[model samples]
Target: MISPRPSLAKRAFDVAASASALLVLSPVLLLAALAIRLESSGPVFYASWRVGAGYRRFRLFKFRTMYPDADQRLKDLAHLNQYAAEADAPEASGEGCAACAALEEGATCSPVLVGDGGEVICEAEHRRRQNAGPAFFKLQDDPRITRVGRFLRNTSIDELPQLVNILLGDMSLVGNRPLPLYEAEQLTADGDGARWMAPAGLTGLWQVTQRGTGEVSPEERIALDNTYAESHGLGFDLRLIAKTVPALFQSENV
Candidate 1:
């Protein structure tokens, strides 16, 4: 399916906002680069392959927040993933959840299931079995994060380099957050590929609404991304941008 064209006004806003921010924050960006260099022995920036609207691939830039060998260490730290541990945990009834049921039946399970009580139930274990891991991985205290990395991640200074992405038309200031290659693959396998129709951004509805909260599962994040893709407009984008500022100050870092 073809992705909808972004509004010209939105593109105009992205250009203006990103350019102005980069120009005004040049000194701060430089200092961040220097800090990363001083503390690490690798490139100052990390360029990750990300899936954007229409499954378009692009390099998303961020100030390096982890050691150079961080990716290599992911397998060794698999046990430390909070989501993975949750999936492995016994349910309240000391039985397996939907994920286990589906896996036992040799069938795929939905990423989310709504209980009769309206609680969001996750089938992360099923996803892990099918996709080899959770779509969204977060560790509360990852050993891979350097001292400087933690501070940069907490303050979100590491994200400043994304302004260049916006300026280059690779992303917008307000849209659905781009997914990493691995995460995108799982979402596609689950029939949630429509979410990729949304423009990629540095901040979006999910980030503003559920930032730093562990309650939101990967399925919920995909649902929110699809919802924004379907309903977002100039007014909604502006509102999300307004909310993002305060959301950043929240104690949780997801």
Candidate 2:
């Protein structure tokens, strides 16, 4: 069974380590903030809703890596999503199937509908096609990243602000990485939910384990998270933290 609360020792370590890191990294944070402000005309920090341990929602902080209008541009860039198989799949042309075309604009051929690549799909075929992959959105060469943002993402300087999250008890130095609401929502349906049994974290098992492995499937990533959740403790946390430094300079901009 998952513990209802973090171990006292683990919590103490999270507090001390996060506090000390914030103190030591304050100047770096300030410089990063300054760079972001100078490079863009938006807030220096970006806070997006993330689902953490026990499905608690909180704003996850990061240096503003994308432009102010990044959210609005996401639909246009959906084809670039690395996790979406829809990009490679053949798309329906004209008005789509005769059954769907006969239905109203918002109506579906079946009672249950799935939206795949802007088209409403019948439930059975949708499930078959959707079994192609996970729902996580990622891009190999995202055009949204600002000049300074690329540097921050590559070096993971963008994640520095999350120390404040750890200090606030919303996260830990070592645990499963918190997921965006959309991503978390998808995981709630099955054994995949086991990934969230531990505290949310700044650096975790999958980040270190998949460091130079190019890209990991969402299923593989969740399994790593579940592994950490099942075995996490002070000793494991320290070991993972030690592995974190080398993994900081990641090849992927995620």
Pick by lDDT: which candidate is best? 2
**Model 2 RMSD in angstroms:** 7.3
**Count of backbone clashes, every candidate in sequence:** 0, 0
Please give the RMSD to the true structure for each candidate, in Å.
Answer: 6.2, 7.3
lDDT of 1 at 85: 65
Q: Considering summed lDDT, which 10 consecutive residues are worst modelled in model 1?
A: 122-131
lDDT of candidate 1 over 23-131, digit per residue (tens)? 9989989988888899989999999999888788899999998899999998888878877666555444443465455564444456665545765445553333344
Candidate 2 TM-score versus the reference: 0.82
Task: Give stretches of model 1 more than 4 Å off.
Answer: 1-4, 90-131, 189-191
For residues 1-254, write the lDDT of model 2, one tens digit per residue: 78525789999998998899899989999999999999889999999999888888898998999999999998798777876754233324334345556777777666456475776576534654655334578887789989999999999999999989988999988888888877788888567888878899888899898977776877688899889889989899889989888887658654
The whole-model C-alpha lDDT of candidate 2 against the native structure comes to 0.81
Candidate 2 residues lying further than 4 Å off, grouped into runs, are 86-126, 129-133
Write down the TM-score of every candidate.
0.84, 0.82
